[model samples]
Target: MNNNNALLIIDMQQEDGFVLEHFDSTVNNIAALLDTARQQRVPVIYTRHINQADGSDMPRGEPRAADGGPSSYRAGTRQVEILERLAPRADELIVDKGRYSAFHRTDLDARLKALRVETLIVSGVLTDVCVLSSVLDAFALGYHVRLVSDACTTTTLAGHYSSLLIMANWVYALEILTCAQCLHALCDRAYVSLAPQQPDQFAHQPHELENTIARLHSHLVRTQE
Candidate 1:
């Protein structure tokens, strides 16, 4: 991976947000991505969604009310804590947010700029909500985005896939890949140089290139399933 790239794990907290299909698998994949980022010396940033003690900070008409109440993400509560499986190191950053997008009402953009990060590798929960929101904001902030499709999940399969498609189409042209492919592209020096551009140049012939593309397509489909 390039030094200018950072992994942004958004809202992977212990809240009711993770009660969805493939949640466990997504967590496991995110853990693997974290390990790869550490091995490659890439920076990792985590975001936790927390509201005020009295729920005054939550947005108007937010779904928190339907999910029991606005007290879910109360500060210092266990629901607002990041999952232990993908805990951040002492040196890593942990940005507390009150909204769906990590960049909203947070120093995320300033911190990434301070680190000279040009590309963000995004992974986390509620693919149709926080992940999508953050991805759009990152694009608008002039940062390239690479989403780990396998390392994110939503309340439903349709929501997850639709979010990915929307980000890739309407929001911005993001590089969407599975966690395994992302790890491979980041850790393998040769692959890193060819990926996101000139991937065909790495293949000798048309058949070889077709096969490579087919493999990646299959991986994406399987991850969604």
Candidate 2:
């Protein structure tokens, strides 16, 4: 809602490594967020997971093509491009990275600093990988984050919710929200969010994952405005 907030969309490329859960709905959700952000003049930043065209910058152990190029998101390829529907406008920021976290070896932090951004509203793909790592790094960089839980997905629903719970438990300055709630917040309206009141609030055993995630979701909607 404040000018200090930014919409950080991470790795929403055309890469097809995994058939992500709820990918279509997630894209629609993010598109809605983007539209609203543009309407409100909120700064929108995007991260692309670009690897070297020749695999020179590929991280150790990353898969490679027969020509020794990075298997995915290789530079100059269509797959590394952001989804056409979610493409950035000229004024929007785009951060390209070779690593999972957008902040890793990138100028994202410095750019956010120049913009005077204090909070990040995060969305995008691979909930257990890039999204997870980026959210954690955002927290570490002292940026308060609002995670749009359903606007990002992983290969499985389990991985999606598990990563969310991990952030809820330890990312102390986080507020786990849905796409609707985030929109409400952006518009300066009353909205319900599942921010942790204490550390380890969503702590649960492996087998209790679903129950824990359900409990978290219940809190988000129970007090809806």
Candidate 3:
């Protein structure tokens, strides 16, 4: 536990382009995490996936609006704004990114370096996309990454868990915990995180998705002492 920890919320903008699994619950969990972070005086950083209003920064082969604008997270639109409930304060850092990874073509790394943030507590939408990309990049950039499982989601549960498994399998010292556990960890309380205990902790075939998810959930829950 240290003061070098920061919370990284990724792609939780108001874009309604896709329906996420457990979105409401995810938002609630993120809210809780935000509350704890602020109370703990931990730095909070938010990312907005804003594309060029004229579609100039749209990813290659991305779907386009009939009017030729970026389909989602259009710059200058409300959709590109962070959720009002979880909006950052004036002193917080807000990073606007045109790509999935917050570190991609953005000053996120530089800012984190300036803040001397060594660990990142990650949560947000599109778990398999932006969140996943951001977590991987964070790891590559030499920051300790912790994920709040319930605070992140994708269009489907399968995508969400699969991404978690992928990261757990390869992120090296990744720590995957639930929202409650994350809150406890922030407070320097006893909390459990499913860190890499062994190689391929979640290794499985595609058909083992359900079983793997069960195993993952097992790590996220607190058992009777």
Candidate 4:
């Protein structure tokens, strides 16, 4: 995934917190990642899981509940709210899902295709379930997937770490990276874009301007040296 990519944060809602408490740390790192994406003008999409009442479980709906527990996670519920740590921008898109995969029963794929997004940086809860499902679908659809290893979690330590190992080994198109590495790649790309190329195109306006500014900085450095 290059600069023209988008970051997909899935099931990063309060409901998942009921199952995993480590979301606090993961969410903080995710906030940093989101901030970096915003600074680089990369699109960010947040997915919230919604469940209908029918004697379902907390997430997928099982068949044992008296007070309509499933409906508690419906759209706009406090549990489904995006965590405050990763504040979504006014223009950022938020998709509501009823199933494990964010793309299922959601316009996520169509929206990504419309934006010409080819690479997806996937991060979120239920590492073995939702995250894995979404990442696998992304690979099937030919989108390069980068999993933010630290920004995902499961209820238990084994489930969380094992998911990373599996994806790293078997997922060819998927790369496992930390938030910092991804941010560095984006920063490197920005520097590459600022470097001079096709001198004629920049010459008339600010070709000399770059050199002039560089020379002034060089002279100041010499004085200090």
What TM-scores do the predictions have?
0.82, 0.96, 0.95, 0.75
Error of 2 at 85 (Å): 1.0
Task: List model 4 lDDT by residue over 67-181, tens digit each.
Answer: 6656445654687787777767799999988778888878999999988898898888889889988987887888888777668888876576556545554566765666666
Best lDDT among the predictions, by candidate number:
2
Residues 67-161, model 1: lDDT tens digits: 44575777767988888898889999999998999999899999999989998999997899999999999989999888888899888876776
TM-score, cand. 1: 0.82
lDDT of each: 0.79, 0.90, 0.88, 0.70
To one decimal, what is the Cα RMSD in angstroms of model 3 from the true structure?
1.6
| TM-score of predicted structure 2 | 0.96
lDDT of 3 at 102: 91
Compared with the true structure, what per-residue lDDT tens digits does model 3 show for residues 33-92? Answer: 999999999999999988887888787898789988888788999998999989889998
Worst 10 residues of 4 by lDDT: 190-199
lDDT of 1 at 117: 95
lDDT per residue as tens, model 2, 75-138: 9989988999999999888999999999999999999999899989999988999999999999
